[model samples]
Target: MASEESLEESKKKVYRKEQALKRTAESLEDDEEIELPRKRYYRQRAHSNPFSDHELIYPAKPEDMKWSMLYGGSNEAPTVADVGCGFGGLLVSLSPALPKERILGIEIRVQVTQYVLDRIHALRKQNQGKEVDYTNIACLRGNAMKFLPNFFGKGQLKKVFFCFPDPHFKLRKHKARIISPTLLSEYAYCLRPGGIVYTITDVKDLHDWMRSHLEAHPLFERLSSEEEESDECVKIMTTATEEGKKVARNGGSKYIACFRRTENPK
Candidate 1:
């Protein structure tokens, strides 16, 4: 019973959807080279996220990023990584303020990753080491969930940020959610003793979920409410995530949680 115009519109919509799927498939094909080491390679094959043309950069491997070797120090500079670092907001915004020597912004989207790279390049040119150095900031376009081990060793990172990640709200889709017991282990593994994980979400349920998992994890201890507030990096996280801005514009409340990685129980 639909009108002729409505039927035509539906046909066009179907065509567009098909084309999008085709493009995504092509992007995946283009990014097959960014896989991790042999043991981790098979896992990444199951989930491939691609970046666009401008998003292309020299791929990083764990061996290529040996922290101690790079700095000639037994302990590397306490590093910070922004997972799902869309357009470099968190890394670029907070780099000037952080005391750490290295900040990594990892984004899955090629176009967005490239955008962040351009922004960093521009900022570097203007600042010229006036306020901060670009040598410490780097962007990598790869699947964060899988490639995390590609750049860090056990307990190598000091802080991690998961802001405004895709809130796969459906019950069946919970596994796809960024914060899970399994993923927490990965986060904990990458974090140094006393390192911290910072997460913010507009969805109350997701917020509670992150808090519960992090709190229950034996490797982590919940940060006090006062500690979360007073923490400079936590404050930066509130403004650095894309979703945080969206939440603010809609007059929604943001739920934040922080957990400090602890030594393994003996």
Candidate 2:
């Protein structure tokens, strides 16, 4: 027969085990309430073609893009695109600046894209009766480098912004940079003649790389400092992006380069 102290110890062990099991069951039940599927957090490799990933968010073609869903019967396609629009500060600022123009923000991360979507929805609801409505702005999860032409027809856009894009610091990963000679041709295809492509970054090397590539590209012409300063959008591009604001807080220098899509060679 066990002593009274031993019996008490056994009872305490059983009680603690029971409590632990109960807590686990309750935790599982709580998890069941979250029905949304988990999104994949990483891509194994950069997509060479946009259409290869059937599950990635995208319209089949420019006509099927459904712009009216965002702008409510506005037939005009989005004239501005904020590529790699992390946290969507630039898009929000531009929405009010160009109330009549439709703008799209392209982000690859699912959670970040969803956050921007929610932010835009909230802004629209909040400003329903206000003079400045936010229905002109929208966010899409996409690989802009691959699928840009899929969403916009040839020469559909007037302005394309690459605000503080990923530097891809490694020499081997440089192709992943948003600005490249090959990508510039695609950008030129989507931008109307004389359309502006605005690029800003705190990384001086990346800035020089982008400027050099755009300068060498046959379809792009570098914008003069006077021309860059004259445009209202340039000011917003510098101060309105989340990355830009962060750089400002850290006292980092910002480099800006703008290019115009020249008309096709005669």
Which parts of model 2 are misplaced by more than 4 Å?
1-54
lDDT (0 to 1) per candidate: 0.70, 0.80
Q: Taking the tens digit of each residue's C-alpha lDDT, what string does model 2 give over 187-229?
A: 9999999999999999999999999999999999999999999
- Candidate 1: list runs displaced more than 4 Å: 1-61, 66-78
> Model 1's lDDT to the true fold?
0.70
- Top TM-score: which candidate number? 2
- Candidate 2 all-Cα RMSD: 11.5
Error of 2 at 229 (Å): 1.3
Q: Per-candidate RMSD vs. true structure?
A: 11.1, 11.5
Please state the error at residue 189 of candidate 2 in Å. 0.2
TM-score of each: 0.73, 0.79
Instruction: Identify the leading candidate in terms of lDDT.
Output: 2
